[model samples]
Target: MRADGSGSGTLSRLEIDSLKAGVRIEDLAARYVPSLRRVGERWVGLCPFHDDTRPSFNVWPDSQSWYCFGACRRGGDVVDLLREAEGVDFRRALELLGGPPAGATAGRGWQSPLPVAVPRQSEAEPELTCEDRAILNAASEIYYQSLMTNAAMRRALQARGISLGTAQTYHLGYATGRRLARYLAWRHLDLERARCLGLLHDRLSGEDGANGDTSGDDVWEHLSQRLVVPVMRGWETVYLIGRATREAQRPKYLGLALPKEPLTGRGRPRRSQGIIVVEGPFDLLLLHEWGYWRQFELLALLGTQFKRRWLAHVGPDDRLLVATDQDDAGEAAAAELMAHFPGQAVRLRWPEEYKDVGDLAQAPDGHKIWARALSDA
Candidate 1:
């Protein structure tokens, strides 16, 4: 835990050797580089330590070692890979691999001979005020009620494999564009605050008698005519993201003026195996619909970037099943995330025909396809 990796000395040589023997170097290397493919006896992939253009990273299962023949030009055992990828010291790496050796006491004064570095923390979400909570709660309720009555919207969702039960479970809603302003006024909520939160806009308001009346028709809903996906933390709606329903809509998604957080699923089982990370909210919804949530915690990145802040939800030993889209950007994002958690992440390999989980869900045997993928992981 110290900057100089001083605390690592407590672990005995036997403990370090046990940790090294328990983990396979080639298997650990594959987590950092998902593209690793077998070449005769050795596996090869692009080097994760640097910008690799060719297959210069080599992993030998026979020797339990890896070497990057490209830009990094370095090679070592599993411990070296963990230290390099996680930016931790020998003691920390051993701890991450499998805690202290049996019968080792924490009170021991022994120190690790190897040096260590401080691990980086992700940026924290901005603090939300009381007023912010009130506005978000009201907006979410109004949208939920709106979706209940909109038969067309319900039918649209059904066509996409999202059922009425699933929609209600996730608190999915529809934005009427004209409802929020009036609802906030009826509740005597501050319209200016809502505008500041990216829920309302004043582009249509004219420069007439400037009395600062935002509750009137002058203000417009920011997510009008789009499907609402409220990112909730327990009972509170922390963030709201909207997806365009119509094909003609230019921007596919929109969000409130808040830090982007992964849209998570409800009730993660106490003994869940790992986190199932997907690209879009729909992809997550379909997975839940097919009963994947029973075994794994689900998270939708909402986009390609995976922030370090999200790591708080993951347990130290839990694996990350990266099921992003099969496209170029998704592949790149998965690789980046895998590299961040070497030996603890696996890129879920989807069938080549399907571009993503959402597309795969449309097939008659979509559930089976996903089951097979998870089993392999």
Candidate 2:
């Protein structure tokens, strides 16, 4: 809502070029830009120019410019970085960098357009230690393997109309109590990491301990007869293990066993290509079935209720479409989604005769309904 166009003490191309050569791009970006993170040697962050999380936004310390792989496709020196991040132009960025003493233009407050308020991102994400990334990847690989060959689990997914290919693509797996625990231990995972990731738990005595022994119930508790769906943080499964209801369970639904901290520390990345927010897990799965899978990745809120904290995770350019059920509860959920996303959110209501995604999938115009909602762009 606040726009400052006054342009003054801008950094000269020569000075910016010098800074790029002198400072590490990651260091320079962290010092000037908030919320940007150090991915490897290069500094990566959400693209302020658009909503995306592809890690496509890159800052070159040598050139002192930034480039977003998403919509803006912008690439320039530090001047350009400031412009995109602050919604300013080169002159204004020069003023910001030159500081008030340099007679540059007056500076404006740095604030994100998203609803939640926070200090600009500080360069504080401890780089993912190799050990950490390895542990996570290993855990994920094992879980993924389980989803493939596990007999009971495969049957459960089939019953839910989910295909084997879907399970594999999402890296889904049932937590066969002993196999998962053994896998973690084999990888030399510390007790804390396994516990924090929600992969370890007590099944035997109902004792509250991380990495507890799994009995028949405990393995099933994490994934028993349920349809398992993995929520990946990039390539790693951060949280989420689900199961479909057993035979004829009235309120048929898949559920998530969130990590110890229900809200993980990381927030949504900026500069994602786009976002598709649906009410249930299969709604995301169903949308994928309709071919909106690539451009629009799905986010299942686990339910219809909107969490206020979720607003902070939204990217500026990201478009969120709500695909709720045709029932009253679905309508209520859709209203809540619009309350948060406003014009960016469109309710994907089904036809009068159909119920929800499940019914639509079973109905004749199912493909048409999917086509209508996805092409709403």
Candidate 3:
């Protein structure tokens, strides 16, 4: 079927098979179930379709299918899962999975409107208001101060090979979860505005007078106990993302209610050798800690999906070093990026033992390996 739901020419069987083969069920499932984890040969996570207390949803990588053995009691392939989860028709789901092959409908009268690429952030994101900017800037300062006072957070940074200086330079902060509301109150800032920006969540019961009173323990910080990383643009905190410092934190990462953009380093490089693209913020952080910023500008996609908006950072002369994770999703992203940039994009392959650059950070010779990879690139 056509992506626009028109009753025109149907997609060829080859196109359908190619979509199923190209996109992994587990990777697509993870978007709905962030808590999904591997179990033996399959993946298991809490069923997102129902009130699943225990993990009953299972995904088989080999078969590329998922089944929820919970109250929902549903199972299907990647397309089926996407259709059910997103309430989209088969044609829409196919469109979302990078659409049909380019010339699948060459002889047909209608042309496919879908682009042969992954979805990207909108070209223009809504600009943050002055009040919004004030709230984010204040929250950034509050989290930075909290990180400074917290000895454990400092040790955590050290363990990750991130120096205190690097942390400071990047404005890395820790969320105590309790201080932000009070800090905003003290500074005469708008608590509701902060809450709207996803920095806070309403925790007060109806009995506590729901009159938007956020100062009196009525709100909880959204990024509590997580390491906060603010994406800044010339002194303005344009975005905020938090990483789980502890293992028990489900989903592992959280961010504000804003369009996902690449987490970039402050200031331009001294000499633009190339742009290193990574999957996670921590991977970018470790590279900065190792002093790669001297020659190369770092960018973290925050995930495998590359947003077209990030193309602004790539110059015609600057090469793109794709250092995504060594997993299926990462490999797919790397391939897509290379296909997009052609000869200008190079995949930086590390040892198979390491899943990503962040995993390499734990190794004793990680810095050496990273330097060698860049040297080779």
Candidate 4:
């Protein structure tokens, strides 16, 4: 609950621990540990932590923990359980499970202390919240995991000339939610937050319509049908863009909206004075995979829908490299963006045959291609 008494919910660590301790591991596991089966009071699931056809994963209801008695033995408390099940970190687990542990801050100052060093909201952009990152990370992880497991994404990558090993190395993932509303509901995410972040539609009827932007639902409605690429700022999954796999789908690509809630800058910085802007996530991943990321940091508009102020945030001293696709759309988008940076923007040109940085990376003369792209700028 917030101090203003407006917020309706809270996240308590004790409550989470109690939920773990009281809830039957079998029942709890059944709810979230996908691909798991319940037997008597114990739950047996395919160990996500290990490779196993046999069910060796066991959960202890009383202990509020799970253990995998397999080659890749792994298990721990409910926190660990959620971490593995959701593929997220501790902070996110805390968010999903609800507030911190009871009495953990019992002795803390009662008086409302000095306001923490909050992020100053940009007048141009509404303040984003810490919860926004939590939702983004969770969604990004789910989409990424889907890509790793989806057969179509792998085939699509191959068709694009990206090798299987390279795809995994880049942590490529896909989104295939048969229904966006159901996915968001399962995660306990508020519909407004999803709508605000451009994850769900506002006019879907029922509870969804109350949220807003019925049109945005069209973006995620085809997720299970698209190739998802996560855009990470440092370790935090801040933004994502989805590309449709089906040839007939209209508006071939979609991006998550810029978060309107206040954003918390807790993790390490993910930008640099030198930014290499790419049109697609695969190209960004390819650059990072090949150690080219360090020479020049990578950033993406996720597409051309970026606000003009987004470019304004880039410091005047920073170097901006436009590495859009070699095709017509890429060239046009690059031309528009180049006009924004003016003196700071440098265009990365390549052979007419190469369509993107990923293509250049895979070329027989990859190093030379990169050199040429860098030099031609």
Candidate 5:
């Protein structure tokens, strides 16, 4: 019943279950995942299914499971990792683990060793066809749900005068526990698909070699402790920016690497939200809270660079508001925006006392000064 004279890729559900139950999570993960080591009660490794520069994958033997906290966010038995890493069908993956051939039967009256139930994918549903947008939506929902329940993140936003209502309005969320991988596993999402979306790290260069740095900032969970601000084009999530709330955390902001072509304005623009390009999400939030966003049609550049896709659909009448920070990089970015759109651009200046919009918004007599500047503009 096979096309290539080999057996079909189908295996009994019971046989696959037996293979998983018989194998240890650590052993399975170590075989496919690289540079694995015991970390306290669990094992940690770089995800083979993605471009992992740091260890985001973990295996818990007691639970007989593994999860990748990074962009992959997928967790399951070693069998899942095998299927992903080897790029093989489910039955082929099981065979690689030395499981019995297809059509093999368990002995009479044989009972499963573990009570856990494995999720089955129908023969008609191929794993290669996972939806990237759905994966991002699921991951974004997880972060949003975590943000609402996180008291610390809520307090930090409140301290910055960002009310819960405003946060929800802007879709501000949190990534806690650095366990997004486990959550994805529970949700039955795909790690490989998420990688292509720039949500997960790519292990392209030097992945096979162990650098042994274990730098905390580059790991998947680095986003876990930060405030998650998603860049959305209508219902679709385009990119994610994580702002560090803790003083000890270096590099105030981190974001995913959008495809170079798309970032350079090659793709279709999502909406005509008006191009009021500010440097950061907080800057955009401050302006929104002060009623400047709608009056000027604001958007956060999310960084200093200009992207083609973000600007591809700009209308001739669409206005440009360059409210970059006073810092060197910010000034440079603002100058670039001005040069890129000469006649249509309006350059906004920040007060000498502050460096960015957030600081300006929090300064004494901030709103009056802002109103005067906007009026002049």
Candidate 6:
């Protein structure tokens, strides 16, 4: 455990403000100081910061704050508790609350105790070209409409407990082997744009010379035989992802190589009080079926690596619920999400019997378990 909180990633003032406003110090303190007893409106327990025979630590759930009237006399919000308990600096504290890695390069790090943005860097992300953006949008829509017409794709959703209506709401679609190239040709869309979206690779002049002329032999449809789901920011499509429809597909999922949008002097992302991040789009579909979206802003990250663009989707005041798959990679993704977020983000662990939320939905008592987790959260 490195306690040198020198500096690393940077968090904005707004993000810090949001974290302080979002995390309740009492719940945080409970992680360090156990055997807490509620008295009046505060939870009193021994201060873990120092040796104490009597309970001198008081955490106010209503105020969403904490303080110690004992020897340590050192008390603050969840960030402070993490700092002292972990013997790390404010930056490390923020990381513990989901800032960045403790050993990341040094800087002012985050000014706010709470972080809701990705670790600040010295440079901004490169902008996507118009053609790149166009292909993403077109391919997404093409796959979605194509999925609606495919019974196998719809059946895949049904097997997962996802309703067709839910799929439609998400604009879920399928990619027929060569439909995109034909559509592009019919619409006179740019072939270069299609190539950029990974829907087409460079056709060799020798091998496929005249083969490209026919739709069946055309190798342009990148996500062929997969269900396409567009990753959107509000109403705008930002990225395109594919889930393999066949069990024999090696990777099971595929994605465009386009870079996700990062925060760019955009003031601040809209606050939704609470945000829930899940692994695949289908997980979101399941939650949507249960109307969970009404309670929290549900975000499906397609696969879990915690894209930089997702930072702009979160507000400093937002509380995050990470409900990723319960596996090694999923756990890694959850850790990454926490590192990037300064706000209060709790990972909702599924029972050992279930692999993920989507898998759990198939269990008879799954909804009951889900409801319990929500109620406890």
Taking all chains together, the TM-score of candidate 4 against the true structure is 0.50
lDDT of 5 by residue, 202-263 (tens): 33233321122233322344354678887665756656778877664434665553331111
Expressed as tens digits, the lDDT of each residue in 143-207 for candidate 3 is 99999999999999899888999899989999887799899999999988886786876552331
285-356 per-residue lDDT for model 2 (tens digits): 666655566556567765555665665666666677777777655666676677668777777655678766
Q: Top model by TM-score, which number? A: 3
> How many residue pairs clash per model?
3, 26, 1, 20, 9, 14
Per-residue accuracy of model 1 over 1-377 as CA lDDT, tens digit each? 22121264354333455556667777678778998987544577878999977676767664466777455656777888999988987667776676553335443434433332233364565677999889999999999999999999999999999999999998999998778889999999999888777787553213111112244477667688889999998889888999878765524676766677789887676678898999899999998888878888999999876778787767779899999999855876787778778899899986899989988888999778988998999
Q: What lDDT would each prediction earn against the true structure?
A: 0.76, 0.53, 0.76, 0.58, 0.62, 0.64
On lDDT, the stronger of 3 and 5 is 3
lDDT of model 4 at position 310: 59
State candidate 5's TM-score.
0.57
- Clashes counted in candidate 6 amount to 14
- C-alpha lDDT (0 to 100) for residue 94 of candidate 1: 71
For model 1 the local lDDT of residue 295 reads 86
Candidate 5's C-alpha lDDT? Answer: 0.62
